[model samples]
Target: MPIFNQSIRRKIVGIALGLIVLMLVTSILSMVMSSQVGILLDELTNRYIPAYGHLARANIRSLERSVALRRMVMMKMQAPSEEEAYAARLREFEEADRKIDDEAEAARTLINAIIDDSRTPSDNAGLARIETRIETALTELRQAMNEDHAKLLKQVDDKQMTEVRGTLEHLDTLRDQFNQRIDTIRADMLKQVFASTRTVIGRQHQAIVISAIVTVLAAIVGFAFALLVSSGITRPVRLLLAGTREVEAGRFDKTITVSTQDEIGELAAAFNRMTEQLRHNERIRETFGRYIDPKVVQGLIDRPEVAIDGERRVMTIMFCDMSGFTSMSEGMTPRGLVRVMNHYFTVMSGPIRGNRGIIDKYIGDAIMSYWGPPFIEEDEQALLAGIAATEMVDQVPALQKQLPDLLGIRAMPAPCDLRIGIATGEVLTGSIGSELMMSFTVMGDAVNLASRLEAVNKVYGTRILISQATADAIGARLELREIDHLAVAGQSAPQPIFEVMARAGALTGAQDSLRAHYAEALAAYRARRFDEARAAFNAALEAVPGDGPSRTMLGRIAQFEAKPPEEGWDGAWRLEQK
Candidate 1:
């Protein structure tokens, strides 16, 4: 098998074999070093570095405990006025003194052990000095405690108590001096240990780095040997694979070349030959750019293997049709018609692309576009498409002058206009048709409804018509006029349709009043108060005469009053249209 197609198990085995060889070589070197040099280093560090520091700390603690016991003994000798108190205090002091003697013996043994461990005089001298200070302080404290105890045994008096206190204070001062000397020696020993440990750690780091360099060099040599053995089969294959990616990215100007005379070399030659056909196809695509949008054409070329039949997803569909094209196209010849159509499409495509809407297909003077399923953003698809549609309609007047010869007499009577319909719902968007020839397109009820509404704009004289679903998704961005609540052909129930007039701009007083009265009417209707709803709808009509939304609401109220709905009726208007 080719190396690029090698299974994960083979890769793992190769890495494991390499690491095992590296570990075996490193282990043998480590063993040899440990026998010759490592043992002596360990002896020097363990015996010399820690020995003096351990002895010093042990001696300090022992002296501190001994002085504490001596003080306790002196206190006990003078503190008891009762016989029981005297005996208990004496026993406590004796126990403390025994503990101190035991600790001192332990320190002696630890110092002796250090002396045995060290091979030099300098290591023993510092420790011996600390031990001598501790022993002198312990002896002085014991002698003072003994003298104070003998004096206090005679009688319990203020004079005897003062003598014991003074002796204990002296023992404390001697113990403090011994502890300070030991602490100073311990500090110096610690500095030496830290310095030694840093040196050892640095040496170990250098050894590991040297070992790593050796292992990497061995691996490189092994890899080169493997490549030399397998070059006849692998080198040409690698070149062929690399050339395939370059050709896939449309860089066919370069050729794949392998000088080896092998079967793999022949395969590389064939692969390069295959790319030449692709290069020819790419040239044809460049020529086809004159007829259709290049982006749409490229999308078709890139995904030729996609299945035509696919599932549907919720998407936003937009249809834009030139309003005055019927009369305008009559005066234009074939060439003039193509020129005018190109200019109209150019203007429309800008806003669509600006808003990230994909141009699905063009139908003469109309455009079918959709948002999502090349990409999807929650709640933003419909809103952006609506904004683009509004801009496209607004640009019709400016675009009309550029097509005067094409428009002829109809241009003077009625300027070119644009009608847009946007609907957001579930739609199948993918490559659709036979395997040999497929186009990226969307199909479903939503797409048909959008197309139907685009046609409906002519009857209503409205520029943009959006379904209630799109309006609800857009939320409060634009002021929408409820155009009708009618059941379109093939739908079972009436759907609320809205016309988007303007976005963000301040609404006129009439528009505000109309909205207020319409909201009130809707609320009353939901509450099953038809008479009240009718009154509110009338107020809305007064504020804005010929208001389509208010008229629809008033009609609904009259219908419901004439024939009341069944019990448990919820006010929900259903839509049955494309």
Candidate 2:
């Protein structure tokens, strides 16, 4: 039941633990081997070798000092003209001799220590040779010194002096021989020590090689075990992963059949159950989409988890209704009406989606969509939705032609024209309905205004009507005609609305002139120049009689000029309805 016991994870953990233990053991073995090597080196260098070298060096220094002192004594015995000078030189020689004797004793003690401790025959023989040399040097130096003293006491006789010189020479030769012998002993002892050190180092090297080979072998064995353990986990886990991917891709028939009675098997069972539930859900989605848009249904389905609450985002809402659809449907069979409606919805939905607007819902003979809410890019959404509306209106003529051939039903020469109403404003958008069944939709004053604008398109004989807010959002890219200021049906305020005719390039010269006159009238009205505003409005009507905005402005100017309302009143119009 432990979490780490989960199939693939357990194998990984086991392998990691094994590798860590192996490394720890190998490191400990290496440390033990290194420590043994270090101890052997310490014994050879710090114990017998240094002791032998130290004694040999001490003996050589003592011999050299003794010879120098004896020569000085001889010089003093020959050259002393004054008693004081002779005594000073004699004292110097005596002090030097005392130092020499002290040094020799120290050397003898060190050599004896070496002889006692040395295990090798060569080392013991070297120490013995050094000891004998020290003794011979000491004896020769003493005899030479005594002879010089006797000669000095005999009042500097020639024959005695010659004998003294010969003895001094003999003493020097003896000292030289003693020093050579000590040097040989030092060399021999060093050679023996080096040989021992080399042997110990060779053993240490062999130990290191053995340790490295063992570590490698252990790693190989551990890796094999790790792979075996990992296989038991990875094989089933890989199957599970592959099966999960297939399920994601809608391969519901694919099943994971891993039969290990481990946690992997449990996962495989759980995955199968999950896939079954997904299959049921998919069937529900298909059935639901037959009645409503799948996108809307999906939006509703995703709402709870995503918390798709309403947001106050600037958006363009579009409402399109088939003109005279009620009358048209009344003349057809129920099946025929349904078929035509489906065709209409299909054609319209493409442009809406292509323009990046989500189709919120479709009432009978009408489609409602919006630019924002689950997602939005204000200027781009407004412009594209406007463009899509224009494109849909243009396609109406072609759709009328294709209908008869595709449906095997004689179509009306002029099918009901689409009246599109676009408005931009803040709207509440998300899922709204009972828990048993809900729908994704947008609702607010903006959506209502768009609906009302579609209705007003009947009054203006316009194909597409858009609010000023949408017009402003769309900017100069779309060609528009000032439609009317209408108190659309449900509200107290009137909104200025325009009919989008085409993109800028599609406007005719007359349409352009009417737009220009309407702009002048609107500007004059805003300046509160009732007379000039009326004149401009009349000019717009001359160019396009059905200019809805001009007619609305003319009515406002007449009402104001009659009573000449408040002196400070600006001619700004307001929509009193939705």
Candidate 3:
């Protein structure tokens, strides 16, 4: 609670500052350790190593000078009174002596620089004493070698062999002493180099230990702080997720608790309010769902203008009724009858919804559905309606198989089948009841014609009958057989009617021949050629023996032969009952 009292902005800033401080501490600690390491490296490379190199060079030079002096003495003794050879050997000895002096002087200069740059004054004093010792010893050796070399040259020139040999022995001893002093100075420099290296190693070890400790401490603090901050942020998000899952599962009874005054808390409050509103709307939806189709109810809710006022639109309407249902239900119990009807409607309604048709209502053993805009594209309604009818006709065998089991009967005396009619034309569609009980439905000639055609299916002994408008709109999409030109019930004008044979080109073999024969018969009958029409109708029956339209026409032709119409008969038969 105390933590939640702080604003999100303040918490965020605090977390950022904590991380920044941890980083700064790590950086500063590294910088200090690195500076110390750098200083030790500088001393080792720049001063001690260079000083040792110079001292070693001086030692080599002293040995070279001794070798040159001995060579010159041998040359003079071997060629006494050869002044030219003696002079050449004398110059080589002098050059060697000069190089020795230069080397020793360079070594002394480096030692002095080292002493000056030494960290401890006591260490510098000790190094200065060694430098002085090397200088004094080198000077003595150089002077003795020069004097003895000159004396040997003169003795050789004067042909005095005893003096030359004696001078050589003294020169060798001075060279050895000079080498000893150079070695001493070089050894002291080596000690300094090793001592400085050990000190650097110790300091590096200390820096590493200290850095490791500080980094570990910072890691602990940073991780703890980050965990605390992240937990605060993620806890609310998890609660929101749980709440969302509850809403998704259609349980809107729970409300999320707001634990803070931040944005997440405000969002939780809003979500709780939304849940309550949704619960209320859901109740209203359930109440309306019984009286209204779910899709229509949602459509009205989404686009309220559709229910506010009626609109005339071109749509495809279909009426599907169970044939022989009255006969089938006569012996069935009340429970069995209800069960059979429910099973019939359930199995038959699948194709309608599948093809995007909206079931308008169920009247006894009949279902009225329509397809048009707001549910499907207006242009596609007729084709879709035809497809649904074909699929419904296809589902009949399965529904018949299911009905016996549903009614707990082995078999029914009169099995049920579907008679469907579809018509495509302009129709009025919208909410049509009083204010107390409004219903979204379609009304007009198209709707009425679709119903009339459902009944006409029985008259023609056909399963599915579609009006001329619907057939034309459906075009070549469905396999069709022209049934008649009929003036049914309320209308005097004739309308072309057809039976849907199949969804596509499934009526190609004998069925195609049957359709050809039936077309010939219908044309002959329309032309008033009774004998030819009768013969063609019989030929159609031979092609498809149980064909409905061929049988219906054959019977009609017989009646017409018995009592021919007066005049101006356009081959349209008027139905007296729907």
Candidate 4:
């Protein structure tokens, strides 16, 4: 049988045998060089770095010992009669002495390790002698200082000031001697460190020279081998490269021509299959985009990871409900009700989307939406949400006018207005629900608070109620009136709520006075001064007659006079309703 008829693996091995032999020779030479370099690196890490580090630490400890000794002698001479102070200084001096000995011992231990690892252990005998000399000097200095410290304490106890001064002067000399010995040891160790560094550098240079000679020989052989093999496959490779470029440029209508019967031919066949799949995916993407929002569909396509996992982020949420919707829908036929709702949604959704808010869902007459990152910028979410809510309220009159015509009636039986609530806080956002039926939405305290605030509007008779977090986010951009601090049902902490009055600098004169008087009244009521609270609240009513919040406070004050609240009332109205 012909050799070409054998398996492709055997054919490739036969063709490249010369190259394989060359590679083996090169690999063996590399391994030998690697072993030598690795030994040098091991010494660098285990001996040189460690020994240098310990010596440096010994030097620092020696300096600290000098400082501690001087402080001890000064404190003793100044307060020689104070026994308690003298004892504390003595402890400090002992701790310093212990640290100096420990560091010196650590350096000596590392030097011993280096000696054992050395090719010529006798060469380090000089280092050993210097270390011994330094140790002896430190010991003598410590003994002399200890003796003088004891005598100084005795003289202080005996009230002999003259003798105590003399002992302190002796201790100062001992501190100087101790520093000199440590310096000598440090200088010797430094010389050894430099010598080791030079030795490592020399070995590194030798390794590099040997490696270069071997590498040059191997490269020449490898180059000749590569040229022999590459000549046979160049044509097919160029064909495959051209086909890939076409596919990358979105021209998937072509297939690579397979001219070989080897692995290259199989690869070409696979490339054709991949191009066909790419064309099919493009068609599917176009069709899928029509059923889903282009932005949402592209998001899923671009980031498959976010499709299943949820992320926690700070977001602004809004809930808007049509007032008197239940009664308004009672008289309308189902068809007419659907017409009104569709138009209402069409009109309301404009502001939200225009302001970069996501309309999450529509629940009968209510709309839930949110603004946050990945969909909108974080810093602008709150302001966008507030703008959308205010715009929705502003469009209510136009919506009311259009309602009668849409229902084909002379006049609507029930009037319509908006009650909106906005809040900013952390919420979990992602695809929610079972895998079979999932929807992208936000779920957390912020969403619930927004819903509760929408309900609270009925009690306050306010158009919009916003949490303090939301108000703070929209600072200097919108005019706001403090409504009340309320602990809504299912929550423990009282949140201060506010009403959106108008754009900043747009509040009418009368409205501004109403806000001022109500703030004063609310403060008094919180202070538990019912009589003053009542007067201020009455004045607020005069400024804006039929003010719901002001009237609410007045009625509460009457009840408080009859039966006051329990002790520790923080002036927050705890709502029992959901």
In lDDT terms, how accurate is model 2?
0.72
Model 1 TM-score, 2 decimals: 0.46
- Give the Cα error of residue 282 in candidate 1, in Å: 3.4
C-alpha root-mean-square deviation, each candidate: 25.4, 13.3, 11.7, 37.1
Give the 10-residue window scoring lowest on summed lDDT in candidate 2.
569-578
Taking the tens digit of each residue's C-alpha lDDT, what string does model 1 give over 1-578? 35423333454465567667766787776565444335435744555444554545455455655544554454545534445654655566566566555555555455555556643223466556645754665576567657755554443434465665665566566556655655664565565455556655665666677667766776786676456535645666677778877877868865777554445656667776777777887787778654444565665556544333455778889999987787767766788788788888999988988887788789988999888644548578888888898889778778877677554534444467888989889987566767587666788888978887887776556789998889998878877776665455556656777888777565798888887887788778878988888898899889989876667667777788788878976675544434
By TM-score, the best candidate is 3
lDDT of 3 by residue, 27-123 (tens): 8998888787777777677766777887787777667766776666666667334556657766776777777778767767766876676442226
Provide the lDDT at 486 for model 2: 60
For each of the candidates, give the backbone clash count. 1, 11, 0, 0
Consecutive 10-residue window with the lowest summed lDDT within model 1: 3-12
Clashing pairs in 3: none
Model 3's TM-score against the true structure: 0.61
For residues 1-578, could you state the per-residue lDDT of candidate 2 as single tens digits?
Answer: 24234556565776888888888888888888777676666666665476565546655555655555555545555643445655665566566566556655666665576467533223567667766766676676667656755654453434366666665666567556656665665566567677667867786897789798979988898888777666666777898899888987878877777566567878888888888888888889899766666666666666664335655667788999988677666667677777888888899888988877787778888998888645555668789889989989988987777666655667664457889899888877656788898766677888988998887776666789998898888888998776555667776666678888789788888788888988888888878787888898899889888776577668877887786767755443444444
Off by over 4 Å in 4: 1-295
The predicted structure with the larger TM-score, 3 or 4, is: 3
lDDT of each: 0.68, 0.72, 0.83, 0.79
